[model samples]
Target chain A: MGPLIPYDIIPFEWSSIIAIIIGLCFGFILEASGFSSSRKLAGVFYGYDFAVFKVFFTAAIVSLIGLLYMDYLGHIDISMLYIHPTYLWGAIIGGAIMGIGFIAGGFCPGTSLSAVAIGKIDAIINVLGIMVGVFIFSELYPLFEPIYNGYFYGNITLEDSLGINPYWFVFILTIVAIIMFAVTDMIRKRVKKVFY
Target chain B: MVNRKLVKFLSLRYKILAFIFIVLAGGLVLLPKHEKQEGISPEKLLANTINPERYISTDALAEKMINQDPSLLLIDVRNESDYKKYTLTNAINIPLKNILDEESEPYLNQDAYDVILFSNDHFHADQAWILCTRLGYKNLHVLNGGINSWYNTIINPKMPTEDMAHTEFELYAFRKAASMYFGVAYPEKVKKATVIKPVTKPSITAAPKKVIVKKKKKKLPIEGGC
Candidate 1:
């Protein structure tokens, strides 16, 4: 009775339309929240504005809580949701590269698109850079295959990997996030303010 | 004054974080530990389908078929060739791979019939049963020894020993008559060699094969996701 598209409760034809609607709404929300500005995004690195951290972390926690509660109430079967299959080194190395890229470029893929929607020339260039990176990686896949396919752990949730109860993990995460938020605020005060 | 200023400096963002933290902490303390068992755990599905009630014995299926029970639906899960060679009367051929197809869903997922799935042995039928059970389909039963048992008991029943109970003999006699009704020559008649030669050969021999071939062509096992 849940996961409508996967369960065929909603016809397959509507999937593209639904995806477009969701994507548009997501972009609109991001743009409205001033994510189009690279300075605001870079603030997370520089310890100036923490909008990036606050927004992203809040969204994650909110969705985490919503999904868990929805699953508990039997409105949706949480188990059916796809977990990204973990390739340990690939994730660590790829994430490190992305983190470096994020600090340097001040735009991740999604925020770059939102910036592009508002006609930011830098974001347009950033998107081109991402495309080129993707193209280069695809062309050189054989060279990177070892790292890409190495340490193949199946799709697993935090609880599965850590052997902790999901509720306790969520509670711990929430506390950690709260402490980070406080720390970020203090750091933002100490850092010299840069107006964007 | 510094403490009040500090409190005032904690903006809407911090307020939201504080609120979420308190809620999460409360939830963790009060709520029972939610075990995050990912994706309809295979172990649980195995346990669910392992129930004895999940199987319909060959004898019970034979009785239901003999009665021409409208609520009984037999599903042959063998390959097309095997199903064409021999299958139960009125059984729908939903080969193992096609059991989850949209076409077969109407048959397997419905409660209107006591849907009994069978293959050559219990192997394929149990596989189908596990699949249907995992997908949360109810009212499905596996044919306990599948068509192999059906043939052994119903199509060519063994006569009871002399010392067997009257009820056992009665059941065997009923099975013998059912075998005759289905046009299977008894072992005793086959041993006589010439006794059932005329009775066993006819258009009745070609009818099942033809029907199965036609059904196989119509239900050409569509590829479906598990």
Candidate 2:
């Protein structure tokens, strides 16, 4: 049942139903984990709390390991998965914009939707702000088209780009993540609590 | 001194996570490294050729020629005698053994042309395809069922049976037009001897071991906004 869509085990007609179920689960999990709290989300930047960093990093690493293990065991064909193509300069610029937005808004796109479900007026405003940003980008698409489309990198994987063995890269990343977790805890203890 | 106290009070969850990471890292280190396979393997190349999309039907080839599709390039992989006796219009003869020769390199490797290789049946065309795939050639396709199929389908087309589908009749009509365009005189009504079997009909056909028939589905809407 793993990678059900790609294997065509789940028919194409079931995609929308599957999507809604997945979205519901995601929103439930996020809300249950206290991610809907803007203060808790923003605490990562200020080093007041490290829950966001710890949870996200753990989730990423766990999924990475799980997928690698599944692929190694031949349960799923990883090559058949659609990888989002990379555009070098476009990625850098887009990431920079996103980072700034994340820090200022205190609610990511997903979390903001969760927040809105709880009737938070601020979350509604945040969602509207995101919509406005999207509208502006679409309107001015021609102007930004060159930058958006430049530096095509053909959906290259991290291992391909860095020229390192995948397992070695995973090992290195796990070590780095552990170090970051330990460091973030230290910073959180040192910083004065904001109690928000 | 403070860091030592914090370490002493480290939570059980953190300890377990740290253990998992360390174990995974150690396991990764111990695993034997194997070089990744770079290009298409012979088995995979053969398997890919089983896909019908890799074959341009003889009728389609005739239609393309009729329309003067500049991108289409036909290569006859039979001997010079067979090629001279009868070959598709504007086809170049490059014998199966000579496919890798220096003179044939440019004809085989161009991106602009949809290079179609053919033989009497699919045998030599498949061999040519295998050679091309192994050597990392792009845009090379086998003419399905090859020249024999070409003659049966285009040089003389058969009218559809009484109970046949409308689409089959439409295809027969198109094949008739193609036959006429290629200057091959075909009968209005096909005799039992002249009637050709469907392309996938097994007795005379050197068919693949497995043929996966993919069902057609309506195109789904583009998914994901964020």
Candidate 3:
């Protein structure tokens, strides 16, 4: 269970510092890659840009494949990795709300934080919106409990539930990502240009 | 052939594509994450299940019981009814059903104890070890040969001599019964009769696996209990 901090290899005190450093790098890469702009983030919804999709999908696939490879190499056990529990309704409802949040605020949590680092006023607004969202969620936690804790299937990964080799899954995901990247590029070429 | 078209040229979103190589590069760094190679196999587990860590041993465990370390969370992976008969001092109850529930209040926000699981044979403890390890719980250890080895090594070091006193043998038998019940008894069977006189052999004996499980180097007093 690589939460390296828990193993005591790295002390927990460093987690925040580590998080900030990771965030800084994340923000730097994200903003430098043009995620700071609201229009860019919203392009996915309006069929103008797929950069957000490409970056996120690529990262997920890469990490999945890399972690699985590490498992195969025996440097780590794949079984120990954390899996977000599947909440069927949460996935659908929470995802829809997030999509709305994405379209309205034009900054998801990470991008907004990165944009805030660079001192974007709109990004600051988006962040405040997020805090309000967080507060609302907490206040209404009881009402949201049905989706939040309803469909717990236990800590499960794709490999654990599907009974497929992680390597195979990662390989498939990588191939799918590559195909999406290529397809998206083609689609972007044809879409009506929306200059921001 | 033509100057960049407006759609391809105008949007900053295409910049996200530039980092495709970066993601692949990140994978390179993650591949060698763990310094130690995991050599997990059923055979290795079968071979090394009873093989005790140098820090853990029968004498050390027995000594720990005597001193009574509060930090020690000695778990008996056996069933419940056996536990009721008698258990070591200050030991808590958690059978194999949710053995990993040391912090099992998963649904609720609660702190679970640091639990150690033991069984009659090292096999049970070892099995629990595998299960917990897979589940990613930290700080788990096997109690060598659960209660069986404890009876063989720590509780009784000498063969039952003809002159072995009845009361001493009774004490050992009582402790043995406690160990078995606490360490392995599941399904909650009532305590067995306190038959203490010299008997033909111990009811629970760990053979072939005996030497490795119970016969490892004894733990010195320097390191605290198992």
Candidate 4:
């Protein structure tokens, strides 16, 4: 029956309000889970903690399974859901930059925003740096345009390109995530613990 | 001893995690996959089909054309050959067979225009209408009686007898004016015999011809450039 906005079940005017509510909930969850703590977040990179990995992987699998179940029960139209388009080189370079940023700043965009809400000086600097980066990117858009727009692949799903059955793919992915979680926990136990 | 060791290896938390994964995986594997339905359900389609509101009568269609309603989009659903031979002014040809094709989607699956489908008769037009209707297309209507009705009513209308009701006479007069608007030429005798004031021809200007100027293709830098 959904997406509610596209189907007009929920009017388009309500989208921004709905998005704000979801964003608030996300920030609250991140803060509650100690994600706003730079030391806690950075622990994942240093191998002292695997909370991020466990939480994110659990969230992914839970949402995947839940959406599939909803689709099967005729509650939602899975095909109508938006898929972020793949821009091959753009994604590769952007991800590398993001990964480096995460390591250096000890907080990704969302967690940094959560930290900023609690008046963390480092998070405020990080957010300012993010805005500066965005401004620079916009100013020099033409320079980045080629790589950014190149190798454009239209909105596609894993099932589309890989020719895999969605159910089987999700099942295998869930198993893999479970294995990774257990491995991360073992690695965390062996590593020297760093306390904030 | 093996059971006790297994219990020790898998703690209560792991046990719960494993249980959740197993249940999810079981549901995924056991649930029957239903193929995505192409269009509206049969029940909805049936209800829509029986609705008479979907048909725009020839007179109403003619009236729209005379008024040059911007929202009205006439679709000639006959074959390409027939379309080429004869079609309504500004009407786009989309044969019934190609009604569901990707190329026709921009024309049919839009809310901006009230697209009316018509063939020689109601048959092909009705078929196109049904196909589009099933796909949940909005603002679609079948031109009742199609082009055949248009020709009979607008292009060559029957004059009302002297004893006919005033409304019938008025309708006949309107159709005569519409026929002239569509460039239908009546005999001089018939034209002069009308007691009503002469209907002035609508001023229609020829569309400006398109002039094509091909530009030289410029080669750009290869992709993945810094």
Candidate 5:
């Protein structure tokens, strides 16, 4: 009911304002929880500290729970949100590349931007790398057109592809994440800390 | 002074929290459903095209024509020659070529009419609908199956190509080599819809510009339907 944009229920103008507010909240939360550090973000690969794991898992779980609650409570419709298309080959290849990039640069796009806000030099380099990568992708789009357009399942959401209710999926995913969170906390205690 | 006020505010924290909770609950009650409303429903239609109101069934439009709803405006967004030949009854010819050409503003400005547009296919109608709607025209609608559906439902009413048209068997086809050379689709059992209307041919003032649009609307030779 409450998707402010696209419906034109709320004026199209509120979209940018909402995005800015959401981004600010997101940035503030990440910065508050010490996600601005690259070494901190990189610890998922190195097994030094699992603060990243705890924080990320908690946030994901929180959002999932919140979305489910919102859907149930009828503040927002779950069916309306844009689901990330499952490009099987693209998701596999692109995710692998992003995982590698995450480990190497120690910052994903969101964290990199937040870090840049605070004048972190390494994050600036990481952000530049991301920009260059995006530029290269755009320029080379013609060459990659075959791959990009090869297998389209037509904007299918996870529910459409998997034949499951989104609420149930979110609930199950929440359970799994909670388990993973508990398991990682144990693992984090075991890994010897290297203070950055 | 500020510390005492701050303490008082802190002491009244439950009241503020209760206020927020009540506001959220009130909003949940007040905000309208995003899906049920019209306008392509940019979010949930993408989310679920099965959403009935958001879906513009071309088959349904053909049915509406057969039933003769005079209020429905069918816009032919194909070029002039394509439009001049065999547009449906009461359908307006606003070709895609001159759609944005400023002179065609009256057709685009028909917000009162439930305008369903089409061409050789849905591509042109969809473009027109998208263009008009994106420019803030709410009444402009898409003819989903386009003229192909006009052929299927109004012309012949056959089984669909995708999954065997769920409707009952009402027609068959002439698979002969002679039919192919002529480029006639839905050849048999398809009569001009307006032909049955006993044409004393009173200068059709019902038509806007004295254009004899139905002249090219003739049926081919006999066969069953598909």
Candidate 6:
């Protein structure tokens, strides 16, 4: 039934407004969950705090299971959903850069933005760094174009790539996530806490 | 002593979280596995089936063609051999079998054009329409009565009787003009010579063939990502 704008069930003109509303809610939730604090975010790497891991993993699993249920009940046509195309080398290289940035600066892009909303000076610098990186990438696009566009595996899901049943995949993933959560709690207790 | 230590490690909050996860996993395990459905629900398809708005009449299509409507996209769903034999001006051939192919996606899935599907008759075109509509394509239409109707109405319109309404005569005149516009020859309009040349072969009045060159398929730019 949905992917409403594509189906013309919801007029395309309202898309921008809807996006703004969703973005606002997302930012509000991020700030409320203490994601705006750089120390809490960086603690995941130090084994002192696992809030980031728990929250994001739970969000992923919840959305996955919810979407599956919705599809089964015929509330939405899951096939109509847009999936971001995968670029293999681009993802690997970009992920490495983002991980380094997250460890060093203590904020990812989305959390940095939420921090900036609360007037954090560090977040402002991080945002500026991100813009500079974007500018550099744009300027050197021709040089990076090969890696950026190479090894494109068109939009696909676990079902397509791994040939696994989505239901079983989600169930296994939930169990793994719960085990990880318990393990992280134990690790946090053993590690010396760093006061922010 | 080991059991006490394990119980102490698993706090109340952890126990509750584990319980919730177990329930959710149980639910997921119980869900019946099915193949991914690429089509819309049958009820919605039925609703679209009963709606007559999906069919565009030949006269409306002819008018759109004459006016050079930018949004008009005529898809001849007949096979290549039949398509090459004769087709409407500027109509692209996307055979019924290949309607669901990746190459046909850019043409059928876009909203920029009023994509009209047609065949020799309504059968093949309707099948194409159903396939596309099932995939939730927008701005799609079936050419009512297909090419046979186009031949009867636009190519060789019957003269209306005197008892018929004025609108019928007007429609007939429009059709005759349209037939001429589409390059139909009238044998009766030819002047007779004193010496009649013997007809070698029986005249077969075929519609002028206009082959539309297919454009190279390019991937459509998809929107909506973070």
DockQ-based class of model 5: incorrect
Steric clash pairs (candidate 5): B160-B165, B171-B225, B172-B225
First chain of model 2: TM-score? 0.95
What are the chain A TM-scores of the candidates, in order?
Answer: 0.95, 0.95, 0.89, 0.98, 0.87, 0.97
By TM-score: ranked, best first = 4, 6, 2, 1, 3, 5
**Candidate 5 local lDDT, A1-196, one digit each (tens):** 6654644678988878988999999998888888999998998877777777866765665676566567765666666676766556777678898999999999988999999999999999999999999999999999877777666566786677689955556556655655665577677789887888
**Candidate 2 C-alpha lDDT tens digits along B12-129:** 7686869888787667667666554434555767677666676888877888899999999899999999999999899999999899999999999789999999999988998998
State which candidate has the highest TM-score: 4
State the fraction of real interface contacts model 1 keeps: 0.33
- For residues A1-196, write the lDDT of model 2, one tens digit per residue: 3477866778889999999999999999989999998899999999998898899988888877777777666566567677899999999999998889888989989999999998888889999999999999999999999989999999899977889877777788888899999899899999997987
lDDT of 4 by residue, A1-196 (tens): 7778876889999999999999999999999999999888888899998888789988888889989988887778887788899899999999999899898999999999999999999999999999999999999999999999999999978899999988889888988887887788889999987778
Across residues A92-162, which tens digit of lDDT does each residue of candidate 1 receive?
99999999888888899999999999999999999999999999999999999999999889997778978
Best by DockQ: 6
The regions of model 5 sitting more than 4 angstroms off are B1-226
lDDT at B63 for candidate 5?
A: 53
lDDT tens readout by residue for model 5, B1-226: 9999999999877456545534443444454545333343465334433333433675466456656766687778988887787776677888887777787777777667777778877787777766666444656677777777656644554432423332332222221221222234532313333544635556453352223343223111111232
lDDT of 5 at A20: 96
In model 3 chain A, which range of ten residues has the least summed lDDT?
A165-174
lDDT of each: 0.81, 0.81, 0.65, 0.85, 0.66, 0.86
Candidate 2 chain B, run of 10 with poorest lDDT: B214-223
* lDDT (tens digit, per residue) of candidate 1 on B1-226: 9988877777465586588666865575477655554435476687886667888887787778788888988889998898888888988899999988999998888778888889999999999988888877878888889878888998878866555666676687688788877888754444445434555666564555555556446433321110
What would the TM-scores of all predictions be?
Answer: 0.59, 0.63, 0.54, 0.74, 0.49, 0.67
Count of residue pairs whose backbone atoms collide, per candidate: 0, 0, 5, 0, 3, 0
Candidate 4's C-alpha runs over 4 A off are: A146-151, B1-10, B40-53, B60-107, B110-114, B119-124, B165-167, B173-226
Pairing residues by index, what is the TM-score of model 5? Answer: 0.49
lDDT score of residue B155 within candidate 2: 80
Worst 10-residue lDDT window for candidate 4 chain A reads A73-82
Comparing 2 with 6 on lDDT, the higher-scoring candidate is: 6
